[model samples]
Target chain A: MIDLQEMILEKDRLIPLLRKLKKESRLIAPVTNKHGDTLLSEINNIDRDTIDLDRQPQNSLKSFFLPQQEILAHYSVDTTGYNFTAPEAAKETIYFGVRSCDLTALLYMDLIFSKPAKDASYYDRRNRSVIITLGCNDPFANCFCEATNSGPYLDYGYDLQFIDLGSSYYVAAGRRKGADLLNKWDYFFRTVEEEDQKIRYQLFLEARGRFNRNIQVSHACHKLQEEEVAETIWEKLAGRCYDCGGCAYVCPTCTCFSVDDMAIDDSHGTRIRSWDACTSSGFTRMAGNHNPTDRTRHALKQRFLHKLKYDYQKHGKASCTGCGRCVDICFGGVDITTFIEMFTRDAS
Target chain B: MNTNFIPATAVIREIIRENDTISTFRLELINKRVPFSFRSGQFCMLSVPHCGEAAISISSAPNALPLFDLSIRNAGELTNAMHQMKAGEQVGIRGPFGTPFPMADFANSDMLFVAGGIGLAPLKSVIDHCLFQSGLEADAVANITLLYGSRSPSEVAFTTAISSWKEQGIDCRLTVDAGDDSWHANVGLVTELLQKELITKNTKSLICGPPVMIRFVIARLTEMGCASHDIFTTLERHMKCGMGTCGHCHLDGKLVCVDGPVFSLEQLQTMDVMELGT
Candidate 1:
C-alpha cells in the first residue's frame, strides 16, 4: 500500500469533505458573524453559512479547551453530607481551519495543565478534540509568528496541516488521527504529484519572507535573564496601562486563572475557574486589603518577565507565540513586542 | 466538568477561638483515599460551605494527624464564613501542597522561630514537631526558642500553645505592640525581643509574620552575624489553585505554590520577594 502521508485536495471539494466530517462529529470553523468579525465557532448549518478562512480569526482556540469560564465541580451541603461530582466527560470535536499559532498555544496549554498533575477538566476537552490547522500562506501585517517559531507555516504539532496553493490545497498529516482520516476519505484526495511538492516548497519560502515585523524574541529572552529592565521602563509601560485586561484576555498562552465557588442558593454551589490577568489590580491582592505588588509602577513587570524570562528558562522557549493579537488589541501601544523592542535595544 | 478542583471532605472536630478575630480549626479528614501527611510550611486550600477556598497553613504537628489545626484570621470573606462554621460540620480540602520546610536539615540545629499575629500557626508546626522528635529521636533539635508578637494583649493568640511550650522548657518570649492594664510581658516590637537572643553558628532562624516584621527581624538577625543561608522563612502570597497553575502566587521567577512557600534567605537573596522586601 502506498504511504499517504501527504496529498492534495482540490479547492472545489473542500466544502463537500467538511460536510461529510460534520455528520459524525461536532465541526468548528471560522465563520464571519453578523457583525462582520470572523471567529472560530461551531457550524450549525454546513450548507448555508459560508466558512471564512480568509481572515485572521480575532480570537484563538484557548476558550474551547480552557474556557473563559467553566464549572469545575458541583457541591452541596445537605443532610446527606458535603460531596462533589466532577464535570461530565467531553464530546468528540473536530476543529477545522485552526491557525497554526493558536494550535501551538493549545500545545503550550497542554504542557501547563499537565505538570504538578493533569488538570482534569482541561484535558477532557483537549484529548477528545481533533486539530486541523490552516497554515498562513500570507502572514498578516501584525503577525510575527516566524520569530516565535510557530507559523506562518509549521513543521509539526498539527493532526493535519492544510496549506493553500491558489486553486487547490496541499495537506500534510502529522499525527495518527490525521493519517487515519486520509485513509478513510481517500476518495476526496489525490496522490501527491511531483509538481505538488515543488509548489508547496515555493509557497513556504514566500510565506517566510512575508512576515512584516522582525521581533527580537530570543534576544529579549536572553537579555532579560542577564540584566534587569530599568525601573523607568516599567513606569513607562504601567503608566499607559489602563487595566483593561484585553492583552491577557486576547493572549493564547496567558493561561493564568482564578478559582472560586459561586453559590446557586444557600446549600448548593459550584466551584468555578475563570481566566485572570496579572495586569489587573486584584490579581495578587490578598485578604485584608493587603496588596503586595505596587500596581502603580509594577503592574506590567511580572507579566512580561513571566512570558519572556520565566517560561523560557523552564520550557527552553518563550511562551509568547507572537500571534500578534496582543499587538493589535493593546490601545496603549504597550504590547509585548514593544517591551522586547525597548529591552533589547542596545544602549551605549 | 467535575474537575480536579473538587476537594475531599473534612469534618471540623473542634474550633478554639484564639482571639476576637483569630480561631484555630481542628479538622480530621473524613475521606478514605486521602492519605494526608504534610511538612510544617505546606498549606491546604480550605473550603467552607457557601464560600470558596483559601490557602491556610497547617498549624499542628504531623504527629497530631489524622487531626490537624488550621489557624485563621477573620480578614476576608472565606475566613469570615469559616469563623461562623460550627463544629461537626463539614468543609472541603484540596492540598497538603507546596515545598515544605527543610526538616531533614533541622536535625542537631538550634531552631529559632519568630512569629507575629496569625503567622505563628505555621511556625508552631515546626516547633511542635521538634518537641515531639525530642521524645524519640537521638539527633533532635538542640534547643527551641520562640519570639511571638501581637498588636495588643487582647489581640494575642495561641496563649494556651505558648504556655504549653513554655512549660516544656522551651524559651518562649511574647511581645505586643501596645500595652494593656494586665500586660506585663515585653511591650515592644518582636525585633526588640530578637535583639536579646545570641546568634551562633548553628542557629537556624525560621521567621513568619507580616511583611514589615519579617523585613525588620531579618535585618536584625543578619546584623547579629546570622548567615543568610542559615536563616529560613515561608513567604505568603495571594493563592488560588494549590498546584501551581494559578498565577496569584507568582514571585519573581517562582510560583509560591511550587518553588516555595518555604525558602532560605539565601534562596531569596536576589529574588523580588514581597515578604523580605528583596
Candidate 2:
C-alpha cells in the first residue's frame, strides 16, 4: 500500500527529473510546434523538446491508447482451412502533462470499456500506461470543466498530479506509480514545506475563479432526465451539423468503434477496428433498410442525451468533461456548451 | 487487439431458400471443439472477408447444438454477399450476443407468437424451443398460437412447416396481404387474425416483423387488455461489435446489442425515445 504524498520541486530541477524519467520509459508530453498549436506527442529528445505546461493540447490522451484504427486479428481462408492470430502487445509509456479534464475523461472511459465485458485491447493498453495530470491555472475561453465537476483541479484519478506554485512546483501522488516516480527522483522532490502547502491551496482557489465560461451543465442534466428538449432545438443543431463526427472524434469519453475485415489476398485478410460515430446515418441503419433513429434530429438528440443524461443515470456521472475541444473543432457550433444553454433555457 | 472483436470461422452446411429475397444458412463452427450455444432472439455478427459484417438474428433453437441457423435477407452489401455464397464456403462469425427472449418467465403463460414477413425468422427459434425442446408434452402448456403474415401467398416462408406445426399442437395461423390463384387461407393483415382468437389472462405476446406491422399489432394488443410488459418484441439496429463496446446499436441509454434486440413494451416505455414507425 502507498500513502498519498505531496512534495515540492524547484524550477531548476524540473528538467533533470524529466530527463531521468526519459531514460526508462517512452515519454508523451504536451508540446507546441512552430504553428503555435499544442499537441500531446511522443518526445525522444528531452533537451530539444519544448514541453508546453501552460496550454491544453490539441487532442485528448485517448488517441495514444485507443488509436483511430487497429488490427484485431489476422486471418487466412483457403480450401482446406482457416486460421486466426491476435495482434501483439503494446509498449509501456507515461503520459506526462495530461489536463484534469482529460484525466477525468479517461476515468469515465475506463468504466465504460471494462463494464459488462472486458475490452482486452483497451485494458491492455490502459494497464501498461501511467498518467501524470497537470491542474489548470488558466482555463481557455470556452472551457467549462468546473460545471461538470471534472476540473480546474482534480483531487484524484491520476498516477500523479502537478500544480504550479510560482517559483517551484507542488506535486502530489495519486497512485502507486506516482509514489514510485517521486521515490525515483527523491533528490529533486523535497518534503512539502508549510509555505508550499499554503501556496497550493491559494493557487487552487485562484484557478477555480479563472474559468471564462459559466455554463450550468448540471442544471441541464437534471432537466434532460425529466423531459425531452424541444424538437426545434435538435432540428436547429442538426441543420448546422454536417454529420462530420468531429465532436465525437475530439471527445475523450466517446468510445464507439466499428470493426471490418479487409482481405489482403484471396486467402488472407485482417480484421480491423476503427473509430465510429453515432452522428452518421449509417450508424443505426439495419441491413434490412430499417432505421429506428433515422432522422438527424433524433441522432443529435441521442448524442447529447447520452453525454448529459443517459450516462449520468447509468454511471452516476455525466460523461462530458467540458474540455471545450468540441467547441474549438466543430465548424457548426453544435458543442455541449451550446446544447446545455438550449436545454435549460426553457426548464421549469 | 481485442479477442471479442475477432470472429471465429464457421462453414455453411446447407442453405434453405425461404423466398425470393431471403435464405436460411445453416452454419456450424469449423472448430467443433469450441462449444457455442445460443437461446432464442439472440443475434451474431456475420462477416464475409473483404466485404464486411452485419448483425443477423439466430433462427435456430439453442437445443440444436453444434449447428445454428441465420435467416438473412439480401438487402444490403454485406447481406447480398452472404446470399451469393454457397455451401461449404467459409465465413466469419462473432457472437451468440444480445438478450434472449424470456423463455423461463413465459413458460407457464399462454404464448401468442406474431410474426410478419422475415420477422418470423427470430420467432421461429422460440416456437421450436417451446414446442419441441421444453421437455413438455405437446399441448401440455396453457396455449401456443402462431399468427404469421407475409406480403403475398408466393412470398410466404416456411410453407411446408405450417402443417407440421399444426401436427405438433401449435395453433399455426397464416395470413397474407394479397391473395393468389392457388391461395385459400386468411386474406388480410396479421392483426385481423387476432379477432378470431381469444386472449387469455396470462397471454405473453412474442412479436417480430416490419416496424409498421409491429406498431399496429402492439396498438391492437394494448387496446385488447394486454399489459405493455406482457408484449415482447425484437428491435433491429446497425451493429459492428455485437458486444456493448460498439455504439452503432445504441438507443439513448440502451445499447440495443446488449440491452436488447429483445425488449418488452414496458422496457421501451421507460426509454428516452424509440422509433415506432411514426
**By TM-score, who's the top model here?**
1
Q: Which ten residues in a row have the lowest lDDT in candidate 2 chain A?
A: A287-296
**lDDT of residue A105 for candidate 2:** 93
Alpha carbon lDDT of residue B59, candidate 1? 96
Task: Quote each prediction's TM-score.
Answer: 0.98, 0.96
Model 2 chain B weakest lDDT span, ten residues long:
B132-141
The top-ranked prediction according to lDDT is: 1
For candidate 2, the iRMS in Å is 1.8
Residue B249 of model 2, lDDT score? 82
| lDDT of residue A149 for candidate 2 | 96
- DockQ (C-alpha) of model 2? 0.67
- Per-residue lDDT of model 2, residues A259-293, tens digit only: 88899999898888888888887877766566778
- Off by more than 4 A, model 1: A1-4, A346-348, B1-3
Lowest-sum lDDT 10-residue window in model 1 chain B = B193-202
Report how large a share of the reference interface contacts model 1 reproduces.
0.81
lDDT of 2 by residue, B1-278 (tens): 56766778899999999889889999998763367888899998887867768888999888786789999888888888888999999887888899999887876788999999889999999888887654775433477899999999889997655677788788888999999888898999999998635588899999998888888898899889899989999988878887887888887688888999999999887775454543
Interface RMSD of 1: 1.3
